[model samples]
Target: MNIREGKKEYLDMQIPEELHQRMNDVIKLDRKRRNERKVICMIKRTMASAAACLVIFAAGLNTSAAFAETAAGLPVIGGLARVLTVRSYHASEGDINLDMEVPAIENTSGDAAFTEAVNQEIEKIVNDYTAQAEQEFTAYKEAFFATGGTEEEWNGRQMDILVDYEVKYQKDPVLSLELTAAKGWVAASEERHYYNLDVASGRELTLSDVLGDDWKNIANEEIDRQIKERIAADPSASFFGYGDNELTEAKFTSVSEDTEFYLNAEGDVVIVFPKYEIAPGYMGILEFTIQD
Candidate 1:
């Protein structure tokens, strides 16, 4: 099937409950193979001739000389791996960029060069897998169209494909893989309000009141919970201190994987709290320099 770029479509027309489950399953599988050195190399090669240029542009390389050159003797390896993981979220495209070094594979002869070759081959697998995912989704959508459904009928759903991968044979000699999938649906606003209760005990709002105070309060509460969880779990303790300092509220003006927030009591802007890591590494938190 001739696949065209910019053709917005999904894997199915109706988005059945079962299909959502299947889509999520496929997505998990894709993510498992997402950012191996093979995928990184493919992205780097397709975007530019010099790894440095691509690093500066796609990966967001910093002005540091260590980042400006190859890590070890390999192009786009170590530091690149960290950058890819940090910004990509297993996404094929995004605005966030990496500004760091890409470590080289030390030495070129024998096993080392062979290991690099293996890494490049893995990159080919990622590119091919990504292309195949697009093709599969397009083919499925086209087939669905042949059944006489209008494009408008297929408008609400999306096929969100993702991939994740790791190098088992970083020093060479082995190949192993772990893959999973997740298929899901985006809920309609009506469906969302289906079970929601109004704060004042009135009927749930229609389309007009969808973004009213009730929804905002719910959303805000969710955000606060997430931020507090991050601060409590961060290894760096970069944001909230680990002990019994209660956080009645958190004002988050900016949020990402590395989030920034202001706690209720101290009224200070704390930075770079990894939501999941905040609680686990309190000892390490004391070791790092945390700025208020």
Candidate 2:
């Protein structure tokens, strides 16, 4: 027999249907791999071209090697339109300068990337604003409290306001207050329980107490009412009261205790510490006040 012709050989090697399908899938995978390689190569080429352009631009503008490296390394930081100029000067010699532009950091989907970027920007803005506010608060402290300064003193008393919002905390809210004075000192911080309410509502509530009781775990059915009564009845004052040989002058007074619940609106509660007992050598008074 003569050697098989081209068509005969092709027909003889023809695969079964399932095998043919499998082969087709393999071919598709190979094609996909090749396409992926091509795209990667294109990206590499684009990045290299961009890096070269950036290097040239930087060199023409007298920017440094470090800046060029930064621009090349951080593609995200490199792609931004606005250039930030960083300069450093030494006492002995030459100054160093850098120009940086941020890149568009993107995620898998375009929308997600945009949203994440906007959120990051907002976070930055909030952080900057908070930092500025903290600086102002510090300056206020220094100007008012530093002795030998005649700046019109800012009430110079500690006023603690529970910041409700307009500021996002990175952590749990920290409770603190600062009272700065040029000549005075904070002796002792104290608190007392009292009551306040309006008549028309007939709904009554206890006023501010510095260390309010946590009645959540109580097993008693009337625990809340009992707490209100206990707090109301001059409750034996359990917190650092009446130390030996201290002059006492202040008293606890109530403002309002009404069960008019309002969201973020001021609640009816105010407790005032009028007279504070002073220990020997302690000239300033100790008082605590709550307002809502």
Best by lDDT: 1
Model 2 alpha-carbon drift over 4 Å, by segment: 1-110, 147-292
TM-scores of all models? Answer: 0.27, 0.17
Clashes of 2: 12
Ten-residue stretch with the least lDDT total in model 2: 36-45
Residue lDDT tens for model 2, 1-292: 5566567777888677899899999877644432210000000112333454445555633556654454454323232221121222212111111111121222111123433443354335334533443455556567666755554554444322111111111110110111111111222222121112111122222322222453222212232233334446644432221322223342121222331111111221122222232122222222222222
Across 114-230, the per-residue lDDT of candidate 1 in tens digits comes to 435434544454446445555555666677689986789877445444344432222111112222112222210000001111211122223123223353344345545554665
TM-score of structure candidate 2: 0.17
lDDT of 2: 0.28
Regions more than 4 Å wrong, model 1: 1-110, 166-292
- Model 1: ten consecutive residues of lowest lDDT: 188-197
